[model samples]
Target: MASQNILDVVVVGYGPVGQTLSILLGQRGYQVAVYDRWPSLYPLPRAVFHDHEIRRVFHAMGIGQDVESISQPSATYQWFNADWKTLVEIDWSSESISDGPVGYLFNQPSLEALLDRKAKSLPCVAVHQGWEAIELHERADHCELKLERVTMQDGKVTRSGETQTVKAKYVIGADGANSFVRKSCGMAFEDLGFQEDWLVIDLKPHEGVKLDVPDIGQWCNPERPTTMVPGGPGYRRWEFMRLPHETREDMQRPEKVWELLSPWVDPEQATLVRYALYTFRSLIADNWRKGRVLIAGDAAHQMPPFMGQGMCSGLRDAWNLAWRFDLVLRDVAPPALLDGYTPERRPQVRAVIDASIAMGQVVCTSDPLKAAERDAAYLAGDVPPLPPFPGLTDGLIVRTQNSADGGIAGQLSVHGQVQNHGRTMRYDEAVPTGFQVIGLDVDPQACLSDAALAALDQLGAYTIGVTHDASKVVANRVLYDVSGKYQQFFAQHDAKIVIVRPDYYVFGAARSAAEANDLVGMLIAEIGLDQASAASKSHASAVA
Candidate 1:
């Protein structure tokens, strides 16, 4: 009887990742219930940075206006040695293909609050705070989750707990590092061989006052490795590595914290908002999915803070999984489509972890001799190159001659300033959901075959043609690329048409109408749409 009311999806955890997933599911008209132990959002600073790709996700969720209000563009991230000499610098201020600042710094609490408000406005989304998912039972058609209602006395002190059960077609674990869902699934982690404890402090000065500190930089001094970064609008953050002899309790003391901040500001002048010790670890889950149960965010992987991608990566996972789940639940495609999620996302997460660990190695040095050597190498103009942004290497991406190498396939689709009808906005804002067929000064509809067109229509894909001149309108949803980025991208890839997935990844591309049809056919087959169509045909024949 309980199984009769099974939801479309059950999400365990109400953090940013889980909340984002809930809203996405709600937007798709899926019944989603989110469970978390805490009664409210964590009102402290956690993640402080996100890149353009994440900003794109925010826009998809209809909260772009809110994000612009609370976020500030991040500057170059510089690294310096003992003598304050510059080593390697990553230019985060450059424009990303997503049509915004490469990176932005913002308060995590504010972002989460905005997400919570948006989630509440949706009818299909229900957040059950003070409830925790404690146990799991997998059935043939649905997953069962046992949830506990937690009662707290003094804001956080747990007083009592009551348990209940809910069934869902699928279960997603977006909980933090210490996830009960991951443990319930008996999943293990593959340690990437990196761990360190560091004391993190957040401070805010009196109104109309500003603390004097570098915007963002790493101090690679052998005596003490430290990091200073802008913590949103009126806040600042500093992280100090805990030496071998230091304990977590000692480093968290107010006096010890003051000693670390003495160089920048007087402890008496500024208010210490939050201070805590964190152990940064590098790990990736051995398996992201087991049967109908899947894990995302920290439950799937964890990385050091060097790249500021810890939370951003989790958000990406949510975005990637949301569309796949939506497609399966709607029966638009077969359940096998979900198989691509782990393969497509794990490699991307691994790339982020590896890059973060490499950056950590550069800043976690404790030897005087090695520090001197590093500084000397930098002084001699021998700085190492920063790693390029990671892209998808496998699963649901094209790797053929019709949509040849160096094409847009498997990469994130680029955004440009576009004018649609009389309105001007980013390209993505014009086409927010589903697969899109974009053509450069060409009509994609005319290029696709009847079968391909039928499949795309079934998927609810948007067909738009981008042209440089507004006078030459050749398609219904033609947008004028005012910034010229779109034209540049098409020319560089030698493609007239490109297929973009719902999550804004390039599915494939082609230089001509026939090739465009082939590209669309390839995506249809790869995503199991062809199988669904075949099954429908066989069922009709059997009925006859």
Candidate 2:
């Protein structure tokens, strides 16, 4: 039976992406229903890495500590040649703009379990694990999804002969590469033409047994390119690229598996957890939204695993959509606000896919001659460094005519510790999560007009003042910058005030308080809040 009331959102898929989106929406008090065909969480490893930005997302979900407990911070990701010469080293152990290690490695299933528990604990979230979304219909204001109950029998999904229909104001497809919602909306992928197969194996070391390996790195040996990295807290993972001469069946044989692990550990030293072949690809949906239906995660983009951003990108999608959907559902922003999703996310996703493909190209080379050329280039410093991870490049952000890179807008806002009300905590914890107007050594409230103040209030924005002076710390409006990160950021950008969006991206930075007010005005204009407010009043009058 279908619920008589419409849900605020219905998520199709129960993987980490869907779980993350549901948790974010549910945290904002939305009625969310999640459907997954699988009878239970897939009890194996898949994605094994997440970066600092994703750590912030986990923090927002109130599971930061739990996730940290199950993961290990990564070290430098060193790539080596066939002769064991260092080709390139990417530092992942250093502190990031998000104020933590640049990356962390974890078992995907364990992370999913944590997210699942957090999502289901929310009062407004209903998780239907054994139901599969078979059909979807998007209408003027809502979407209808038909779900069939299924069971896992003999490791396969089988129909259970029960079905139901549910309605929601919006639907999200966090389903993987073969996404039903994306296909239902008649969307297509813009393939980036990168694909390769590899055999991934996970092993749990026997108690008190130790094996020396790279903390996290890739062996770009032309004979058999390999990846060795941490698999959560106590396990380890290794992926070997399938060579042209090796058949998939031959590679999966027990003897072959043993031969591959012989270089690292023997069977007696470690227990094989799981092993499978994966065809990594690079793809991005041409269009991410249709009517009230949208796609995220693997449904929207997929990339090779060389950069370990496959799961991070999806969680980012969830974070981006959560705030936008919150505003639309609350009528704080016009429905057109949803249009910004694709423009803002797709470019960033494409950048990652491109970067991942570039890295994969370097690691997946199997030709000895080409590998030698690549080694020489790296050894001689001819290889170009991977481009820095991209930020939002379009949509709903303030852009100046003279600034080509949006003048610090669309970049991640800096996070640091602050002292508020005689207690110290991370800056995000000091202020409520929403649009933030943070003044460095200035008072944001003193610079805004009454209209601007009213607009910010309507949008639930947090206007805060941060300064090095301890005497200036006020209960809710001002905080003491204990870590000096805010001061350094302001000095670096030469800005006095920074306007951060709900998703933690800087909307814009301003040189003065008046300019900060203008940034707020720009945000209000971009969101079309005035028109939305007018429409609400008109509807109320008609009802009266």
Candidate 3:
């Protein structure tokens, strides 16, 4: 065997995405190095969206369970008039998305700290906080990252100098909207720049207003439209609409900011913390994986915050790649196995962007005629619930062996209760551990010949072959199912080998053992693993 690479992954930037990636890689025993321009996690809170999947990622990192107590549950989603009259209401508590908690009410700082701590806890992860990736170049086999050293003073730059280069086999860019890595990779950000500017202010109400309202509440009118969200830990967020020709001075008038909130809460009780102007756009990269480097999160796609999936989409990308990297890094899968990451993610990435734009059009409607029409239509007493977000394709994608059903059909069934006393194994329940799931509608012994069973016992994959109701099979892999209904995969993507990546996204499926063997062989080939190891009796004996 030739010498293997010393480092497996080099992650750029130390934001949530970067930190999460580092910790995941480290946990998998990969030598991971991280570079970031900033040394400290700012108490600054910038984003607002956190869906159920994001919470699951946090839980996977051992950090999510605390989000709800700090951030109140948004129970009733609504649109209100500037005069404070309700226009439209949707039940946010509908438990619409999944059994997993959806729509976080917390801010960025808290979440980042949680992730930052997790990254530092990993034994194989090294974080270089104050270093920035100043330059980058990829050779035929290796990619090089040049980190520049810098010194800063009271809110200003003091000194900038020498660059240190680090080489890695795989690189991930979670930098930011203005990602240097993305820019250097020659990936273009197609910003559909918004026609209006939005002024967002973070405030801590002196006397907090405790109300169960929305995942987000939109105050819509032609003149001014604002959004209010619960920013956990006594923090409240406000996004005020900015019209053309309006100056920051006009928006800063304490009276103007208060008018938007005074309807729901007292003016004297709230104090503004931070305020900034924003223009929304939905953008996607033409290509996600370019050469040796790949991009995720804001670095790859930028969606308006209207739909609250901005961060969730990115975290899902990290989830999908992290486990696959484990396979490739450990030489378990073929290197080209990484090829599927981009194609699998790009469709959903683009879908979220489109979802945001479509939803934004409805939530932020400003046309006088249209606004009146919306109000009149609501008064007419016939408005369907918020149009289902097509961005959620988790349930729709079915990959199973049951070809007619579009899901993998299982042949594993035993007429009599045949017990494998020697095996002494059953699916572990209670604690949630994410794994690649193989659901058996019946008994496993009936599904395979000795050879196939022997092969599975060899790979040692974290695959739970559960023999029970199809519903019970999906219950353990609950984190990945957006709707907590994984059994639907039977009808969505027809196949028996339902390959689910860590992030809950299906990689692809195989309907038969031959297909599974082919997919497994392809994976093994990529990681430089013994090709026959995935399907051979010899591989099985080694594990045994």
Candidate 4:
């Protein structure tokens, strides 16, 4: 019943997604209030893999090294038949645009602890534990949230009769699968109907002892499909599919777990960290935003763990929303810019969900005959390779009139090392993350008109010239492409100038300075900066 000060954002969960969103907003000096029902961090591991793109996000948050310290780079993910014959092998060790291995494995609990510490350390972020959001009301200009303090004892939660009211310009439900905020907002999940129950077991081998196991692999045995992968630096995880005759309760028993692990290791060699039954399902929210209240992470989408992308997708959502929130909160863009969120992210998430389901179908084939057919198809090269992950197709990205020739509008921008002032560092570390007008061999500032340049400055955009010619390198302006990635990227795209969004997605690219100026103009108009700037000046005059 007590009133509280209005904040910029009220995040209704303290999980990794919530923590990430809060930290991003707090770093930008926004007042963020984060609430969680639990009193402390979850002690068990859940998600164990993140891609290089998410690693770049960690770097943007200034924790790239800390995250790398707790993670192990995944080399390859293999699928094997019942006879241990390799059916497929995905090379996760390949370098990506983020300039690291394609994927990594980490302990979720450790990551949460790191992110929680970072979020709380920011003066702009207020973290409240043991507070459950009871109600959310979206007003014309803001939203009101009601919270109640609760205590957990013996695996039961009890309300303490303490209540508080807080207001925020926006309310984000980064809550988990059963999100109360999602339910309150009347959003429904469109289930893709792919579901399977599996027992997930985490094990920690005794120090100095080694267990014989594939680093990361899926055993598509008709009897029981199994997954063996690293849980982190010093942990291992095994997942066994539940057969038709098995019950969830039976699969979670410690003896049953050890029986399943008998092929790999025994109790004497390793300690069981935790075991639980998880029903992997593919689901996406019908809507991500309902007025001033929005949902993200597991609240917006869920997919089978076949691709190990469930957590990665959620983190991407946080990163995508954080930059948009910053622009909207600062009044640099109209509120309608928020409308681009669902359209841009939904299709990409759906693509991943579909891919994961397709993979699950291949791995979860329990019938011996079907499994044999699947293996034969894979061995015979009859199955097509999985398609590359999709990019934004329906959002704020600029598309050519002929949609097929959209260029690299939605593809990820490359990040490579560059030399500036006798120092070599990653491009992002040298240039802060934002809208970047990067010229491959020309100066972006020289390419744009006065009006366009001023607009870029107003939007806090960075203009940099990158060239392979070392003589062209200038302090804080022109950078030498030490790794040649910039040249290669531009050459591949046939672009001399690229306009990258704050989230590292290319807005558009051009082959000439004139085209580049037009591209910048398109960006300014698309984001409605001109309208926002005029409104701000009008308001200032009225106040005077």
Q: Each candidate: RMSD to true structure? A: 4.0, 3.8, 6.5, 3.5
Ranking by TM-score: 4, 2, 1, 3
Q: After superposition, how far is residue 72 of candidate 2 from its true place, in Å?
A: 1.5
Question: What's the distance in Å from true for residue 194, model 3?
Answer: 3.7
What order do you get sorting by lDDT, best first?
A: 4, 2, 1, 3
By lDDT, the best candidate is: 4
Better of 2 and 4 by TM-score: 4
Residue runs of model 2 more than 4 Å from their true location after superposition: 401-406, 531-544
Q: How far is candidate 3 from the true structure (C-alpha RMSD, Å)?
A: 6.5
Give the per-residue lDDT of model 3 (tens digit) for 1-544.
1124546889987887888888888877888999877767755777756765566566666665665545555566677765557877766555522343345567788778777878888889989877778778898777888787766454454446766788898889999888988999999777655445787878776754564444468877777777887777678787877776688677767777666566666556667787767767777887778877999888988887877777777887787788768766666555665776776667667766776776577667777889788777766777765544332233223333332233222111111111122232211223234334343342222344444444444444444333324243333232122232333544344545554434544434556544554554443343345534544654221111
Q: Point out the worst 10-residue segment of candidate 2 by lDDT.
A: 535-544
Poorest 10 consecutive residues by lDDT, candidate 3: 410-419
Which pairs of residues clash in candidate 4, taking residues 3 or more apart in a chain or in different chains? none
Model 4 spans with C-alpha error above 4 angstroms: 401-406, 531-544
Q: What's the TM-score of each model vs. the native?
A: 0.95, 0.96, 0.79, 0.96
**Candidate 2 TM-score, true structure as reference:** 0.96
Query: Which should have the higher TM-score, number 2 or number 3?
Result: 2
lDDT of each: 0.84, 0.87, 0.62, 0.89
What is the per-residue lDDT of model 1 for residues 1-544, given as tens digits with 9 covering 90 to 100? 1445889999999899999999999999999999988888988898999999999899889998799789899999999998888887888898889887799999889899999999989999888998877789999999999887786545564635667789999999999898988889998999999999999998887777666676899998879999999888778899999998888899989999999999897776788889889999999998788989999999999999999999999998899899899879988788888888888889889998999998898899999999888788878988768657777767788866322245467788888788766677777666657788888886677676566677777676777788897786542456788888888888888888988888888888888766887787788888888634532331110000
